[model samples]
Target: MKRIALGVQYDGAPWNGYQKQLDRHTVQDQLEIALARFARVDVATTCAGRTDTGVHALEQVVHFDTELTRDTQSWVRGVNTFLPDSIAVRWASEVAQAPAHDPHLEFHARFSARARTYHYVLYNHPVRSPLLAGKAGWTFRPLDVERMRAGAAHLIGQHDFTAFRSSQCQAKSPVKDMQSIRIERSGDAIVFTLRANAFLHHMVRNLVGSLIYVGNGRQRPEWIGELLRARDRHEAAPTFMPDGLYLAKIDYDPKWGLPQEAGSLLPWFSL
Candidate 1:
């Protein structure tokens, strides 16, 4: 059997989430169905991250093993033929699995990924745009971008993120290495960029929600530091809606044996 890695993108509006559900639409269910149809066998897939319902992905990584010997091009076209319009297999390639370096890692892949990046978009305007309704979180009140950035700055680096984690989170530990978090304004919208080794459930949204309070003058920017120190969920703001979030990209080490042209396969929005 050959192990293959797929780069997938999907419109999360119609699905329950990334994982397969017995009674609902899911990205994994659709992809597995498509893969079974094309390969004529059961295909089990493992993703780098499981995005919640209404959360989109620009370059979600997944791996599966297949006995079929088709080339990368055929895997792309064959799977796309069976997939729904909202989901697409952007790229496919044979992958060489690396030796496991950390048995405690929660993710399934054997490769050592460098980082995972996520982006959140908030529409801060008087009126909502019909076109971006489900694509961007709508915040009618004006936000102080500078204050939000200041709050975000406190979240960077290694920290215990229990305050930002979801109640349903299954992560074994609350400690995470957050590389960076930045909040910036683009036109009438607020965009947040977050990069981390891994994230707890609703971590990004919770952080964003807390920063929103700071931006609106309801909370001081330094309060974020206090919240981090507290490490309690109740001390943080509510988890924001998932509609504005996107799994932007995952970076892997060069030694993972990925294709030389893999960089070219990145989603346009990630660039």
Candidate 2:
């Protein structure tokens, strides 16, 4: 048996979320259906991160074990032929088997991942953007990028992120290593990028909401620290929209040699 890894990208506006559901249109269901069709058998997949509804992905990594051997290019082309226009298989590669479940595999898509990075695109115009609706989050309030960056400082490094997670979060631990959080502006858009070991449900959106509050001077920069210590979700800002969130990148050990930057989050302003 050969283990295969695939790089996936999708616009989440038309689907429920990444996970498969009985009656819902979802990324997982779409991909698995495509895979099962191409491989002529049932195929199960595992991903680095599971995004929520309307949360797009530029670089999502997934792995599955397959008995049939097809070349990488064929895998990409064949899978895409069955996927909806909103989703695409960007790249594919044979990987070390991660069969810990059977005590014989080498890589687990969700387990072998090291870090994930996200980019949130916010349109900070006094007027809403018609072209960007459902593609980017818009706020009429003018945001101060400097203040947003200042607020993001408290969220860097390891800390309990309970206050930033959704009520639906299922992660056992609230403590996560937040590698970086940065805010920058290009034209009328404010972009926030965060890298972390892992994330809880709605964590990125919740954090961005709080930072947006600080950006608009509604809260002090130091308020982020207080929210962390509070460890209460209600103390944080309301969860932001799903449109602006993108799973930009996923990190793995160099040994895997997975393709890098297969699906780019850039051309960001165009969206």
Candidate 3:
């Protein structure tokens, strides 16, 4: 059997999440069902990240070992036959497994990943746009981007992000290396792009919620650093909605040869 890696993109609005559940509409369930139908065998897939319900992904890397052999292009088009309009297999490549005795092979859809990127989109308007209701989060109060930037600056680099982590998070460590965070405006939409070694559950949304507080002058920018030092979840803002969150991209080593660009896979994002 050969291990096959797949690049997946999906709209999370229609499904519960990436993980499969009994009697639930989920991305993994749909994808596996389609793969089983096409390959005529069971297909258990492992992903780089598990997004929350209503949280979309631009380039989610997943892997599954199968005895069936098919070319890259065929894998993309064939499995899509059983998938819904919300999900599609973008690209496929065969991952080379390490020799049993070599003990150096470290490639995995989740473990092998070096970093993950997320984008949170917010529409700063008094009246919410019906067109972007489920596509983006809406904020009625005017947001000061500079204030948000100041708050975000304190979050960069290595730190214990316990204040921003979700109560349901199961990550072993609260310490994470936040590589970069850039908040910019595209038209009326305020976009936040963050890259981290790994994120705790609801980390991005929680951080965004607190930043929104700073942006609207409800909280001072210094409150971010204070919260970080506190390492208490209660000190941070409430977790924002998942509607605006997107798993924009994932970073893997060159040996894996994964796709680099996020492209226009999702409806709202251009990154």
Candidate 4:
């Protein structure tokens, strides 16, 4: 068997998310179907994380085991040929050994990644943007970027992120290490950048929603710190729309023994 890694990018608006569903189109379903067509066998994939519906990805990672003896270049072309226009396999390579026990076996990847980065787009303008409606979260209220940045600072560390996670989250624990969270405004758009070891469901969206409240003066900047201490979901803001979010990147340590350029072929956020 040959174990191969794939770097993918997709417009999430057309599908149900990364995981396959019985009757819905999905990133994973498309990839697996394409792989089965190319290799002529049913194949399963393991992804770095599961994105919600309408949430895009610039660099999503996955691995699969196949019996095919094709070159890396063929894997990329062949997969793309079978996939819809919304999905693309940016790169592929054979791995010496598969990352360890599959997540499906026990809900954990074999290796630990260094970090994952997510970006959220908020359109702050009086008029709605027809071109960006499904790609960004739109709000007409003016936001105080300085206040949002101040509120974001309180989220930079390991803590119980229960307040920022959705009740539907299936993680074993609410504790997560948030390396950094920053809020920046460019013109009429607001961007939320977050880097973490891992995330629970709707964590970034909920965090952004809470910060938006601070930016609008609806809540104090220090309230984020208090919410963290409280560790209760009701103390946080509502979950923002998934359309504004994107999985920007995933990082793995060099000691993992993968190629140095393993991540280079993946796409990045354009804005």
Pick by TM-score: which candidate is best? 3
Alpha-carbon runs more than 4 Å astray in model 3 = 263-271
User: Candidate 1: misplaced stretches above 4 Å?
Assistant: 97-111, 257-271
Minimum summed lDDT over a 10-residue window in model 2 is located at 262-271
Local accuracy of candidate 3 as per-residue lDDT tens digits, 21-59:
997489999999999999988889999999989998888
Off by over 4 Å in 4: 98-110, 255-271
lDDT of 4 by residue, 94-208 (tens): 7665346654322122244568889898889989989887788988889999999999899899999999988899999999999988676678877788999999999999998
Question: Number of clashes in model 2?
Answer: 6
Q: lDDT by residue for model 1 over 1-271, one digit each (tens)?
A: 6778888988899899999999748999999999999999989998888999999987888889878899898998999999999999988878764447844332234244677888888888989889886688877888999888888888889999999999999999999999987676767877788999999999999998999899999999999999999989998999998878988888876555554233212232232
Instruction: Rank candidates by lDDT, best first.
Output: 2, 3, 1, 4
The lDDT values for all models are 0.83, 0.90, 0.89, 0.82
Number of the candidate with higher lDDT, 1 or 3 = 3
lDDT winner between candidates 1 and 4: 1
Worst 10 residues of 4 by lDDT: 260-269
lDDT of the structure predicted as candidate 1: 0.83
Q: Count the backbone clashes (under 3 Å) in each candidate.
A: 0, 6, 0, 0
Write down the lDDT that model 4 would get: 0.82
**lDDT of residue 10 for candidate 2:** 95
